[model samples]
Target: MGALHVLSGGAARGLIARLREDFHQHTGRTIEARFGAVGLMRDRLLAGEACDVLILTQALIEELVVAGRVLPDSARALGLVRTGVAVKTGAPVPCLETPGAFKDALLAARAIYFADPAKTRAGTHLMQVFQRLGLMPELAPKLRFFNNGSAALQALSEAQEAEAQGVLVCTHMTEILATPGLQCAGVLPKSFELATIYTAAITARSEQPQAARALIEMLAAPEAVADRRADGFE
Candidate 1:
């Protein structure tokens, strides 16, 4: 059988990786997966990328279904994933119980890493948090942006080893939990919390619709709830 082509948001990477072998065993087909920012994944699908299955924000999946890019009845939500703060493993976890504390933590950090604001849900919300706190100018120099949360967290892990002081990252909670050498401090402060529902669907052009649906079922199966929760999916 032909491989199932998948384009997904970084938030689902860990869950998908956990299920890949099982899905392949059950279906006798391997998966070819590409994961990145939701916006970039949407753009890739719209740009004629070959995708049998697509995983992205629920709203984006709805939009694609409306646009006839994804089958209307094939979408199924994985779970809600929140925006969160993370630190390098073994580093001191910052207190972010309040907006003021969150702002202070950002100010105290030697650097801040996040996904591209223009291309990611968490990144955009994080920038808004900075704006609301009136620290945009002061934090601009310390900010570093990457293509997606996974990349930002990876860089954060590497940077913390070289720097003596604290570094902070804000991204999807799932991404934080999935990355090695990182520890999730907590979700964003209540006022700035962003919980996004991620969904998976079969593409309209899928050559293996049955396999695509099977993969989606595997990802959102009731039996996998504990695994999803462990990965920071609500």
Candidate 2:
């Protein structure tokens, strides 16, 4: 068997890290995981990058399977992740309870941070939300896009030191809740909430198919259930 290289989206990072750690301790297998946007990882895989396992949005996994970049029948549903807003721990929390209020919050912020709409599922849906709310044109100037949740959170942390009113950050709830120095501003209004289902599959380039399948099985096993459940995967 060989070391597993997992390419995953940021929302699944916490659960994946914990699972990988536990699996390693139980089996002495090394897992090297790189987490980022699903679209980013999908693009890299399509361009011939080698990965033993790919954990991404379920839709993306199906697309890669069709494109022959991942093995068919090797997919495992990981979790359902919802998009949420975040602010510096001690900063004022914006009201995102209703569509109109959420729109106002976005308009009132000096600067806002989110994942790349083109590269991440949460961001992509959020773009639609902005358009639906008719805030895109007005809020465009204040928007800053990052690669994924972690990058967006990091930018939000830096923005805390900027002007008097801290910047608003929004991304997957899982990532926002996992980090320190950030306050969970709550998920989007029901009318605007978007949940992305994540899945894992053995890559087409995997040299250790058994090992990869074993890991995938472990992910769905009872031992890893609690971590996955707590991380927003259902």
Candidate 3:
């Protein structure tokens, strides 16, 4: 196998690391990945970056197919992701089990953070979530958009130190829960939850098309599900 280059978004971050390890161990092929925000990855691919595989949202996969950048038949559903909220570690996790409780938490927080929709799908849906919950007007002014949740987590820690209620990010950032300064507050209530389906496809111009296809298949296989689950991916 030649270089199997992958272009992927942050949603697949932790999972990609695990997959790459498994792929190399099994096939002895180097898996090179470029991770970015979803929109950034999309734009880069549109600009003709030579990517063998793309792991992104279903909509993005469809877009690439329509643009003739990926074969329509090569698209495969990988997993589903839902928005989760977390606060800095040790900060009191206010109850966000209901719509009203969520609103109260948002209002009480001094600064809230989520990624930008221009870069991530979570940020896109988070805007709609605020609207759907009817708290957009009140919360919009306080919103501080981030490029990634890792940075938001840093800020959250600072806020906690200041005794200010911290931020909420729209990501399946469960891995961050183990960090010393953070913990999951709670996922938004079910009624307001927005789930995004993640998918993978082989790029049309990939020189290693077969290897790309094989990689996708392996990642979606039953054995891979255990690693996916371990990484907080559903």
Pick the lDDT winner: 1
Q: List lDDT for all candidates, in order.
A: 0.90, 0.82, 0.75
User: Each candidate's TM vs. the true structure?
Assistant: 0.96, 0.90, 0.85
Steric clashes per prediction: 0, 0, 2
Predicted candidate 1 versus true structure: per-residue lDDT over 6-103, tens digit per residue: 99999998998898899889999998999998989999999999999999999999999999999999999999999888998888899999988898
The C-alpha local distance difference test score for the whole of candidate 2 amounts to 0.82
Model 2 residue 110 CA deviation in Å: 2.0
Supply candidate 1's per-residue lDDT for 143. Answer: 92
Let me know the TM-score candidate 1 reaches against the reference structure: 0.96
Please report, as a residue range, the 10-residue window in candidate 2 with the lowest summed lDDT.
157-166
Of 2 and 3, the candidate ranking higher by lDDT: 2
Per-residue lDDT tens digits for candidate 3, residues 86-158, read: 7766667889888899889888877788777666667787888778778877887888888765555556656
The model with the greatest TM-score is 1
Clashes of 2: 0
Angstrom error of the Cα, residue 209, model 1: value is: 0.3
Residue 201 of model 3 has an lDDT of: 94
The C-alpha local distance difference test score for the whole of candidate 1 amounts to 0.90
